[model samples]
Target: MNRRLLALVAAAAVLWPAAPAQAGPATPKAPIPVDTYLRQALDGTGLPGLSAVVTHGDEVVHAAGYGHDSTGAPVTARTPMRVASVSKSFTAMAVMTLVDAGKVALDEPVAEQLPEFRMADPRAARVTVRQLLDQTSGLADGGVGIPAAEATGSPAEYVAALRSGHLAAEPGTAWAYCNANYEIAARLVEVAGGAGFGQYVRMHVFEPLGMTGSSVGGAAADGHISLFGAWVARPELRAFGARGGAGGVVTDADDMGRWLITQTGHGPQLVRPESLAAMHAPSKVRDYAMGWGPSDVDGSRLLVHAGNLFTYTAVEAIDPATGYGYAVMTNSAGLYDDTYEVLRGLVALTRGAEPPPAGGQRQLIELVLGLVALASVGLAVLGVLRPSRRRWRLIPPVLPALVFVSYPQWVSILMNGRTVTWAQVTYFAAPLTVTLAVAALSGLVVAAAHLRSIASAR
Candidate 1:
């Protein structure tokens, strides 16, 4: 028994060196700092410009802008960029201030508060102020004019145009995302605050938060679209056009940092803590809160919002458990949007999980589309060289052309009942539109050749 014990002890001693500290499971290294991860994320991203901000409680953990604007200007944290629908959060906050001041009542009818407010629907009279911010006002984008071209270009005109439109559902009974809700809310702010929408917000919200550069209607930089993996700069269709209660609000990373600090229930008390809590609480009808949508992230509450213009895209998020806020904006939007992926990567860092690598699907999609366009041209050349004997063969190709011409009317079907303008289609749908145009033009060429040959034979 003594000899056996000695042999076992000797074997254990020999095996100890093989089982060093790393032998079992390696210790996880800390997540890279926000700034470092952000720089790394920009490495392979085929984007023109990117702006990001991360806030922790009352402090700004990181704020930066990467790449260049459309004018070839280097983007910095101070570079202004359109935050898109993220503006709703600011608009919500602005309204909240009025709510706290007893200037605007949350449950009060908006039409009662703003006498100028009128919609063709009698139900519009009952729409509450809270419904607009929560996006449960029964106002929907369906049947509304695409891009709102009919507006003479003001918030008043926007509301005036709605005079002919009706409601889709009862107030507070359902939830739907519609910009008109916020626009009317902004007009209400103008009336209640006794100042222009921009002026009231500037004095009440921006001034208190030290967000000196924020404004109501403005453009930060030129927008871009991807073409065959290459970025082509394009003008914003509504670059600071009309009243900006819906989508306007050009800002920068630094300003977003300040905004986040306030949004996470930090910074100065813009509104009472209870009012702030009210803003974050999801409504009974949906997970959408006042300005942010409440979603579950790793069993914790995440308040988030995403915005997309034809030429730009952005995302803003706040993690209540950690008091961490993140915002990411890009100058380009088309084929694919990288802003959300970037936001996810940033969110992953907060969880200590390795971030998904920065990636883009636009290049691949556009390349495949370019190849299809080339194929269409080649087929047209062959058809012209030896014209098709059957007219029915040519008829099928022309149909795609009709789809493009009448796209504004039918594109809504693909977008799930959301209206779209022909100009809007030219941006997000550029590659698809171009491909369809190529095939259609090719068909027309072949048809013309066939018709000429038949005439000569006659």
Candidate 2:
């Protein structure tokens, strides 16, 4: 059965939707070699599996999976994975649907729908729904307050806390990345739809786009099929509260492929072409829009977002002008770098362009420096083995490395308040540098003492 399934998957890969013949003749269909690259990338990242889809013009460039399933089951294009924050785009879409219906005004203050919402700054009451969509909400999302684990409480309670949280800056002053604002907008979605937010999305959004495998915050009642072996039933994954508007989506490559098509205005499933253009339209925040971020990828305006939820990561992007897009989801977060590369490659193939390769002097310098630093520290630590252990010496090599990595990310954090780049630098610098410095210094001191003792004996 597995072999047959694999064969079927391979066949589907070749026979997937083709770009129109009007897309400038046949253009000689060549094997993109993306599957092989994806496999190798996944191997290095320790990601259990990945599913990706690419569309060129109207053609489905590729839609396939590589590696073992999230649950060690056979991975197919249909394997459901939590899309994490990527669901934010869908949430924005849902809210915009209400906008289309004239059920909610984008410029209206959110306090009109949820009267209980408040913030530390009285000016926060003036924050409009459009501000939230654009991520200009100046709420305090800093410090160790927010948990890294999955949120398990009622969505209402979670949103209430976010609404009542501190505001470090007035709304529209600067961009502040916070999930709370979206959760609040989601509450508005509930009231506007007169149904559970997830159900409304399912009925209007997912079902219409043929995203049957997509669910906000969880998989279906039948559970998700693993890419390698068996069905891992996730009742909790299915038990999403009202937070579906923020980060509660479970979907696969095929479904997302359909979404990418619709996003580029190739299909008439969701909103109109004008609305999509509006969604992709840039805001004051860098690369930010109504629900998506805009950037010039390969010389064309592209809408993109990457989702993160603990071990899982997903990214999706579309270039409406080129009628090309890509969706990539990984079951493990460790493969983030690989995921980015894979997504880039798929997009390049669809767009019929090769992206600039990543091998640069800076990357080489960092790689060599990292290795040399690691080896030096490791050797020093080996000489400092004490049974009871004692005070350790500190090394200076870490200071340079820390400064090198932290400064840019710190600048980004200071300028944009987005934790994505900020958190990356912080996570890689602080603990690693501190630990290695201590270890190397202690080892160097122990070695010196041993050498002095030998000299005295001689």
Candidate 3:
């Protein structure tokens, strides 16, 4: 018996080391500091007030506001900014939730749901909710003049425009990012939820997500637009009359981050994991599914979308595998859309992987691409200006390469500053923008000369 006991004790001692090895090392949760780099980047670009939120897994480790409300008041996480097209993702998800609840069918035709809504092509009656989400509804870009107005019209007008819209492609055939498609989908939501689309999302999505400051489509209160400092005078409350599913929702970064947490199925009573998976699922008509666009980032699937509504811009992105995501809002639309890519690169870096430099800082690269585009026109101009030996061909193509790069110098400045509400740079930056105008004019001159030579030779 003594000999057996000694043998068992020896066996236990040998296995102890192996047990810890099997469990693996603990992953260190490093504190992700919000740097002045972001603030400087925004400042360097002369953006109005900006807000950013970053979350890893289920925890939002960073949420900060820079600049003031449009009224020279300090902006907080609760201070709302127009999320622009980011509203589409919420609308898409809300519609899908109704589908999951058996209140709406994904394959059902919009005409059937709302008979008052008819398409110019009677065959458009065959357009399904899935087709609209995938951007394959065969709808023309808003028609010449009247159609453009109708396309940008209110919800009722949007549906009326759809009925009057001619099919540019067959359903489920080509990709056309049509706002009307989403507007119709929002109508379906209205039909499905048996309430106004905005009201439904407010109760079902915003409140449940703990988005106290967020309002759906229309403002729950007046004064939606807030200005920061004297950087730009108080931007008035942007009209929310459209309330379409495409680019009409208002929420701050704080509420957006909370909603983003649910993208990974972390928030309360949010959409189910299965539902979220469906939103990310790729469609035959587009690489995008529902309200999200997908791309591989650092070897992981990242779902991303940006919203543009007049002067306000917003973006939301996440890596589903890592549950790492970011949301950024700026007062001016398209002012520094590329800056968001820099922020994305920072998130990638935090994940322990290296990302290339911020593309917005690469003035040389931008100049090269711009010149190349102008060169095509320049070639045509050369034929006219100097009678080139080449044929008089005009080929002008614009390439909007979505490259993500972060310059530490600029980023350090954007992130280090406090919420300073009185610093003004718009006046100086407005004149500095002349540099871009000069470059553009130079390119045009070269292109014109080439074209003139070509014409003279002909």
Which is the leading candidate under TM-score?
1
User: Whole-model lDDT, candidate 1?
Assistant: 0.77
| Model 1: pairs clashing at backbone N, Cα or C within 3 Å | none
Q: Each prediction's Cα RMSD?
A: 13.0, 10.5, 16.3
Per-residue lDDT for 1-458 in model 3, tens only? 00011121232233223322547765654533455446655555455567788877678867777765556666567667776667778888888889889887788887777777786577688888888776677764533122343335455655765555677778888876666677778878887898887788888888888887877654422222212112434343333323567767788877878888888677675666777788878688778788788866556667877765444556788878778878877665322244355466556556755443343322332343355445545543554455433443323211111110122222223323111111111211221122233334444555555566667776
> Model 2 has how many clashing residue pairs?
14
Error of 3 at 84 (Å): 1.5
Clashes of each: 0, 14, 38
Worst 10 residues of 2 by lDDT: 1-10
lDDT of 2 by residue, 1-458 (tens): 00011111232234234443675544455544766656655554444577888876556767887766544676678888777677888888898888888887888887776676665567778888888887787664562123331144655655655543567667777776666667777778888888787888898899988888888766422222221112233222212322456677889988988888888778654776667677787667555886677655556567887765544567888877678888888664321133555666666665556543321222232343356556666655554443212223333423444554555445334424433333332221222333344445545555565554455566
A best-first ranking of the candidates according to their TM-score comes to 1, 2, 3
Residue-pair clashes, model 1 = 0
lDDT of all predictions? 0.77, 0.60, 0.59
lDDT of 1 at 433: 73
lDDT (Cα) of model 3: 0.59
Write model 1 residue lDDT over 1-458, tens digit each, in one string: 00011121232233222323645765677788878877777765778789899899999988988889988999889987776787888889889999999999999999889888887889999999999999888887774443552344766777776777778899999887778888888888888899988898889988898988788776467788877677889877762232366678788889889999988889887999999999989888998887788766445478988777767778888998899999998888765667766887888887887776676445556666788889989988987898756656667657767766776666555444566667766876787778878988887887877776666776
